[model samples]
Target: MVTGLTLNLFDFQEKAVMQLLDLTTDSRCKQTIVVKSPTGSGKTIILIGFVDEYLNKVNSNTAIVWLCPGKGDLEEQSRQKMMKVAPHRTTQNLFDALRNGFPSESTTFINWELVTKKGNTAIKDSERKNLYDRIAEAHRSGMDFIVIIDEEHSNNTAKAKDIIDHFSAKNIIRVSATAVENKRYEFYEIDELDVIDEGLITKALYVNEGIEDNVEITDDYEYLLDLADAKRKAIAARYQEVLPEGKVIRPLALIQFPNGQPETIRAVERKLESMGYTYDNGMVSIWMSEDKRDLPENLTENDAQPVFLLMKQAISTGWDCPRAKILVKLREGMSEQFEIQTIGRIRRMPEAKHYDDDLLDFCSVYTFDEKYKAGLLATMDKAYETRRLFLKPKCKTFTLEKEYRDLDFDGLGEREVLNRIYDALVEKYHLTSDKQRNRMILAGNGYVIGDEILGQALHGVFVRTDMVAEATSYYGTRKRVDTHKHGMQLLHSTDAIKTAIGLSTGKVKTILERLFRKGGNPKKKLLALNTAEFYAFVINNEHLLRDEFRKITSGMSQQLGLTLEPKKGVFHIPEQDFFKYDPGVKEEIEYLSNAYQEYTSGYATSLVRSISEQLFEQYCESRDDIEWVYKNGDTGQQYFSIVYLDALRHQWLFYADYIVMKKDGTVWVIETKGGESKGKDKNIDPQIENKFNAFKSYAAKHGLHWGFVRDKDNRLYINNTEFAIDMADDHWKPISLVF
Candidate 1:
């Protein structure tokens, strides 16, 4: 049997998960680690690695709890991986061990279904008892207990609560594909994305998800063929890993004819059959002769064994296959979610214990990159968002190693932030451009083509070391020849121009090309890193950024002690985060020892709270507890506010379950959980409440609103009113929050 899996995270620090894992090996880190890897990011593989370590290194008394939205999907995927695809210590050994009776109260895989039932209701009695018995007995028997929860966010109903409570272990680990704010525990992260911006998953080609509408397709069959021709090479390129050792995987043309298009399934099926593939549905075409019309009926089966399944349909959200090495999406309008799921299918670790020296096969075949280009870009947007979201919820705070003040290049000496393209053309690409530096590159792409107008020495140094491939050895470094390749644009900027000024002679060609394209002047100067971030902001997100910025400026956020979570992209800062500083704050301290609401968390406060608490103690240290006067700028009221800096961010920043306030009462006594770093943008439209709805109870809670309110006290009142009104209004139309 394989001894154990070792995840050697030596000196890698690109994304958040690395730090998270490094810290997890320690037992005191009770902080919940929310690894915000985008779909297809190999979240499962990482999890399995962690599980393998915990089971062997920790205690066998560990019982794993796996919560899934769909019981069938969960069992199928897990079983398939364990039996068919897992690499180390064969599944047969596991089955043999299990079948021979290793003891019922031993290492196990459990689903929350033990607590949930039909009708989307919960199982509160027998099921809950059975689950607890297994866990408690297992733990009592000196068995280690580990829980791996899948689709954790779906734990909304009371039944799921039964399961969560049944486990009763605070160490229950949750796994989710979406970017979620943890605010539940300390945070760590891992980013599988090569370049993180708009979304997560990346491939040979990058597509931003938001620009779906910009992508064009045509009704004419010729258009498709023409488009396919453009992407045919790339399509074949997708199959490189799967191709036999020496067999070149070339694009197999897929000609879609209206009626025949549906028949494409049969065509692919026949091809796979010839290639020795089996369908999970189990209709062995070699033996069962099903007519074309009855192909679906013939291929349908409830077989138990896993098979090499080839599905043309976009994989659904719940697919958890360890053996799924390939995914081909035939339709368009592919969302980031779809891409993430497809990527996730192949990323799961092989159940037994084999790690491929080569990364798994991930290839996408599209008629044209143009069609899904925006969606792909949109994917990056989501990935970035998901990353930040996941990290925040996990309660991660960073000091940037160095202070932003020190990191600032302010007053370093103002070099030209703008330069023209004339000198750029002559010196850079060795081409003359009548159009100056302030022009667009490649027309539509956001680049400014230019020669090394600012000169190569300085500018060349700023370019990432890996930006250009080295020239042949005999010739020395590769010439920075003019390139028409599409990529994330560097665009017009002061830093870009200044850096361009110093570009090496070899890199002039690219500098000139970029300056000329984006109407950027090369002689003036290029923009700096932060400036570039501002200028290259996504259009659809401009208003969002502006709104968030507005909230930061608004005094209410300051009054409430809420700060802008820049990394989390679009969350509007609530008033409390800005204004609710523990009165115990002092000079030189960047953050508080504990959040003001720590008093309500039930658990002891963290170090962040202690810093602020120390200051408070200076004021009223001897007193068991103390209250200070608090002001609510929005409601035009003032009242006493209690403090215990140790509270989590959510306790005060999030909405409350209920708050009781008599007309003349000074304080808003409230209950319920606080929110994490950020939540998704929710829209509002006025509506009336129903009789049975908890209108009375809801009306009693006030959560702070971003830019909409002012002061910490305002939060208690604001949160109460916001959700109350939401529950009352909101046209029975629920939001999907799909992104």
Candidate 2:
């Protein structure tokens, strides 16, 4: 845990931080890493945690350079967030770096335009040292730079690359909601669903929700603003009901105008003023490139004053106004592509949590532009109008067996991994304590060992033809390849070894030192190479070592005898669960709650079931013998699960799809999947046979009944006797007959 932090990061954020630390600390990792995290995922907090963890774990002279895009004073905003989250750490800026060389173990936030743009005072040659000079000084002082490019897509110009090159960064992490994929860098994406699951953002984004298709868009601007204002007022009322007594939140509506639309802006202003929102009062605010009005310093707070904000593209990137829940995008003559950044502004929950109120938990967008709506939906798949449903009241006494892990078990630790690697090496090479003999054996087994590492260099050229400007067909008249000795770059030879083997820098070092360090334990030390010779040997045999390590890692689980057994305990279904469904769907079941759309007898869940699961649910509800059906959640302690071992012997919990309580006082557990047919089984899941066998064992031991259910050709099949992939197998029968 990072000390001196004001806010505690969620599990997903902490996981991202650990991944960043692993990449930055490992010399074998890629030079560039892209973080494709969704907006409102607390990316800044994750990076700050990474920085603090890296500094604490590794003993090295390191500096973090956070380069923010030039918008909304994002650099300063990021700096303040860092200070608030980690006040104990030293945070500085470009000017501060100029006055003093890049401070070690500190973060320096720099606006890219300040130093990258030509003729900028910070970049100009003056009495004060420029950014380049400071970077050079930091390098001279043995600082390892880790650069973070926030909103990297916004400023991916040649100048930005040039500025980044000045730092000679060991690692460059580019962060954005819409990060582009590049083969040269490793990608780390935080699933948007995870953020929603954590309740950091709205459950869904509704566009033109509840607007009848028959309605004509004769007046696009006023109609959209009217809808937005009504929704905002409704949300404000919901906030009053859900929030604490002293805490207040006024949901603000943002009206976005396309560039060069002065008349349309005035018309919207008049419309807003008529709706009790005006500049004269404190309810309205406008933020533009040159014009600003009634804006408070802290608009993100719950009790901020502004209830309506009008903006034209200035707050698109890196703006954090959580209370702004409604967006009314008014169009001009030209059609504009709506960026996700604009919608992202309203996605964040004001209190960083959902109030379980549909009116307050969902963000709305009122836009008539088809192109803009398409663009917005293209970015977020879950953005759509949804109607709530509650759990039916008839199934109130539902109970099911839930699997829980044993707290005392700690299987497959780092020590086991290290031992397995060591054993694999010894078994493959037939190693002994005799260092000279081991060297001979290694050389004979295709392992290169010499003063210089041997590598191949290729030289070729394409032949241009008159058929095309640049010929697509290439013909190399002369193909030349020569062997060359690895140069002084061998100094970082461990980097190649670690990269090849997919291990951390420290783990690689520890393994190497244990195996080859001079004057070490005779039993463990298999190689007798000094520090210099060890590096050369590693560089020469990087690929061979990588292959061997890959084999060991892939087979590690198979070699280990680790398995999980569920404890003899069970959890029951909760009284309520939240549910959302597309409003366009006309089928409304009577069992769901009218007020909150909850199932009183179902397990706690916030998931929208898949098509197969929904169909299976409908099947269970229609059955005469079934008393009630409770859906099992995919994860968490509140859900029922069965411990199963995968083919690799790795332990995992199998959460069955539904638990059926029959009228005969018997419980039936069913796992749903697409049935196999002669045509194709595109939805088939791997390693399902293992889960079926585990479920069978669990049922027998606990005196319960279980079945594997699959849908094939509009018919449901049950396999309770034997696990088989073929639908025609003797163990399979129709679900109705089995029930």
Candidate 3:
């Protein structure tokens, strides 16, 4: 029922659009939902249609935020798709929002890195508060934001979560091809078979087609290239047969090579040139970090000139070339984990409709790497298989008190943490602006501040042949690896630092150079080290530096004049909640005459059930005094929770398993854990003691009873105070008395 939309939608896409609208506009207070579909299912177009319909039908003042991952330039790609499909709608980016506050009924696209990366000018303290100002301005205008996280699986980092929380959006929708099942979000899925039925994607994927299974692996890359080229030509010929004389379609082949193999690249180029596909004739193109060649303006079009494209790595996520029908992955001895997105590159139909011809309808892959093939199949088996479960109406009245973080107190940002770490190091290690003095002070405190540059060189024999030339047979292992005074240097010290600290290279470099650079603001600089000395020091002491950084960030260093207090507020259980599961698998739980509903649907059923939970559910069902038993979720904002402090004095949320109500107007909270034996304690949860104490304190203050339950040899035990892992301990008693 969407009007004024230029692009026509298929039946499935239209249904999905309507489903999205209904779910978002429902009366429940649920905040998050999920959309799972295959790669070539036109998910972008479907979302654009939903946005257009929502802006037209709804009356509220609203804005849409489309969040994309930093990889692949996906934000720009999504913006272009929105404009091309719905021309009348208003579209903008982060810069536009900063210049002029978020307009009503507009869609804004933002890349995750711009705000999450440390030292990024967009959110750095030194830069103007553009993002915060725009958010405030939007709030003043009474605009509600609906956030959409595209490719949700790839954007689950802590910093990404922080950015999403910063927006304080009214609703969130996550879209991905391989979305996992969570009890918090309402699930929707578009069947891959439906897409194939609609002719939007290829019918099937043919791996190593027409090759004998018993053949041996060969190092010759020419065989796979020859097969892929022949397939591309055949598909192009089929396209010629179907279309008119004026319209033409040229199918392209993609060749992928492993990284750091320059000799193989040279030989492949020569082989391709012999096959009449050369860079001089505009028939070949390459996409790499250091070199790019002869790429057309729009590579997705069927009539683009390049017939063969070469690349050292997988293409970006949003790179869509419908004319790409074949792939030739050349391996160099080592195994690589194939990415699912790479296979999706060749799966789209050129005309968005499949011809009946077998060669044209199927995509071809000619790779002799069995490991890569196995990995691809393993990833492909878990393709989007999802089912939605409705909330039972009888559970509307069951509510409990919970805890949430107060939004008024935004805890420490990355820059603040970095500052605190720097201050702590400066005071403890007696760092100064003088490099030599600082180095001596650090060395005195057991820091590895060596100024020696070290490296290793491989000594090998050079060999040459008519087809290829390379080095072979390395010798003098320990003697060739010599340490010199100052001749050798580390090439990728930034990368090494990133690996040591588990952060982005940019962030690591910023932390190192900003704190120890030679010429900065005199008051802010802790040590004055030039480029060479700085690199040498960091590379030599990478592990020690990483340990120091983590200790401060993890709240272990307390004398840095910083107080860490987590903001807390009260949380209440929602009136309605949903469950999700994969329908393709035979995993389901059914309960009759349940308190929440007549039965539980889509509740994950496992072959190995938790002994405590199984016994407890049966006990409640059989007892006549029990009024009702409500199951609580493990995580998410919609569930009941209690605030607890860990050993580190950091606040955490504890969610109990069951909330039981008795006919005598008594309520009980229970947590389940594995029981212990006399010889060895078997409980594995590290925070068991902390959670138990918190539960007791909360129940006593709130006028409710609580107990910790465990299972041992088909029997149940309950402990209220003084938790002990051994079942023979006097603190534990039979569950019959508690019931």
Residue 281 alpha-carbon offset, candidate 3, angstroms = 1.9
Candidate 2 residue pairs that clash: 389-597, 390-592, 390-593, 390-597, 390-598, 391-598, 391-599, 392-591
At residue 542, candidate 1 shows an lDDT of: 28
Q: Pick by lDDT: which candidate is best?
A: 2
lDDT of 1 at 279: 54
Cα deviation of 71 in candidate 2 (Å)?
Answer: 1.0
lDDT of 3 at 295: 73
Highest-scoring model, TM-score: 3
Q: Model 1: per-residue lDDT, tens digit, 642-678? A: 1110011111112221122222333232232221113
> lDDT of all predictions, in order shown?
0.31, 0.68, 0.67
lDDT of 2 by residue, 96-142 (tens): 88888788888999898886666766556662346687889888988
The lowest-lDDT stretch of 10 consecutive residues in candidate 3 is: 460-469
Worst 10 residues of 2 by lDDT: 458-467
Model 1: runs farther than 4 Å from truth? 1-25, 37-45, 83-107, 111-114, 117-125, 139-144, 154-158, 180-183, 193-203, 206-314, 318-739
Q: Mind giving the per-residue lDDT tens digits that candidate 3 earns over 297-393?
A: 8666889889999876536366788888887777553234445456667888888898898788888766543332211221112332223233456
